[model samples]
Target: MSLFSTPFDPARDTALVTGAGNGIGRAIAQALVGEGVRTVFADISAERVSAAIGASKRPELAVPWVGDLAELDACDALLATADAALGGITHFVHSASPPRREADHALAVDRRIWQQMHAVNLDAGFHLARELAKRLIAAKRPGSFLFLTSLHAGTPRNLPHYSTAKAAMAMLVKELAKTFGRHDIRVNALVPGAIAAGGVRRGSRAGAAHSARASRRGQ
Candidate 1:
């Protein structure tokens, strides 16, 4: 057996996946279910949330909730809902991001974009992880946190809001990793490239909007 054969058993663990409505978030939530881990699928869309649970393939251990995670209250609400549904959340996967269309670059991008991006991408992500870490640390329980960051974090795409939030998230991961490492809690960021996942779909209005926005940003 490998030295790191298993950090935790899926059957005994629970996971929370935000933005689980579609795309990469959907993919990850589905995979977690396949691993036999109890999962709570949360999104801002009620229809999508219901759809995710109904189509879970295995609803025995999966739950769904419509949540606006950008709202600070929703963060606590989600954790409470998950804890009630699955006893306790041992794993957290923050895949939810306030839609990052190819709009509002450094010049045209207003504070609106920055506020929304920072709220969901960095503030909520870090707060959730830190809050969970505090609980686990006090209880002397081991846990893991996985954040979805972008490769564009360090690189400049002119989307100051997005890039800045991603950078902060990276630092959040690093800080959490160092602070919680001693408590047996693992914190890591999944820096993804231009994968066809996320919220935007190709050839759709949203897709076109994103492209138009990006084009306006001078590619």
Candidate 2:
């Protein structure tokens, strides 16, 4: 199959991807642009957003947005900007997440940290997806939504805030899919295993071990 092959039609698909500043989110956003799909690369850092778009195969097809999704206002602002830029987004990818720190484990994590994690992962995700779905339903357009969840959603990551938030997101995906399916809006989740990217610190022991296990499984 061709690298850019997808069910999406380039002429029809316009996408909005959160956390496009780095890691899997950046890769997904860039790939959509490469397939000739106009895409919004939304990130918390302006520098990262600019850099991600600059690195895209078709930079002209990339629109940059910088915002903290932890706030409801920012979520509303993003939907407005994306609609203005794309004339209505047909694809939505929720990959935005607060960086996870090893120190933010169950006991060590503060209320502020826990709240921010849920605010971005669960609250912002639901708000953005539902709002987008509403627009698509009103327009009578078929759309697709993808959420970047984690294998740790079910397993303990020792990071209660991250794991718990993801677990809720897994359920959110089911709830959204069931509700939006009749509207022809598909909702799904991508539960990725340990990768040495994004929030994963380079050369961390946990990363190395996971990589080793993944390689063994492949072999």
Candidate 3:
């Protein structure tokens, strides 16, 4: 009846968010829960994950899943958990990233930092997106996926590791978009500007933006 009205319901949909124990991931998961969507909080911190699960208003709607998303196998486990807990997921939010601070810029950056950055951000996102895409394809289901990217997805910051990963992540978004568009799956990155309050502020921004966008899409 309306341009924004969905024939299907979004509140009834399930959403999976990686790194949802704290910061951006936590915020995004909370937002999805606030929208009445079944939200799965996946993170490496069992304590924080449990806390988030306990803090939810609809505790039944917010399921906690703890694991290292950088490991591709974790995605399968998470999917299984979500499948059992919420039936199936129709949305995914990639909110995982390696530790970052102004102090970790190029002059002080080491190879380990670089590798960890790629492992957590770039590789995890690719693996999650790819695995979820395969599931959607095999099930003949359509879904939406959003990546918590930075403005660096276009312009580079002094953090070469973070910037390069974000840049590659942008390309990953495009690649997925091209491949999945025909299947009615939507893939896009949320590019946030410099939020000075650190990852907390960034997380809040991401949650707010994703909630607004999801509301607009009725998802």
Model 1's alpha-carbon lDDT is 0.79
In candidate 1, list every pair of residues with a backbone clash. Answer: none
Cα deviation in Å at residue 17, candidate 3?
A: 0.6
Task: Identify the leading candidate in terms of lDDT.
Answer: 2
Lowest lDDT 10-residue stretch of candidate 1: 1-10
- Candidates 1 and 2 compared: the better one by TM-score is 2
User: Which 10-residue span in candidate 3 carries the lowest summed lDDT?
Assistant: 194-203
How much does candidate 1 score in TM-score?
A: 0.84
lDDT of 3 by residue, 31-134 (tens): 67766778889888899888877776666778888887667687678878988988777898998876675566789878987887788788888877777778
lDDT of each: 0.79, 0.90, 0.78
- Cα lDDT tens digits, model 1, 1-219, are 322345447657888888787767877787677667889998888887777767766667678878777789989898789878987777888888876655576777787768988998888898888887887888788888999988888999677888899899999899989999999999989998765444433446878777667656644
The predicted structure with the larger lDDT, 2 or 3, is: 2
Off by over 4 Å in 1: 1-11, 198-219
Measured by TM-score, the strongest candidate is 2
Pairs that collide, model 3: none
Q: What would the C-alpha RMSD of candidate 1 be, to one decimal place?
A: 4.8
A best-first ranking of the candidates according to their TM-score comes to 2, 1, 3
Which lDDT tens digits does candidate 2 get at residues 61-96? 999999999999999999999999999999999999
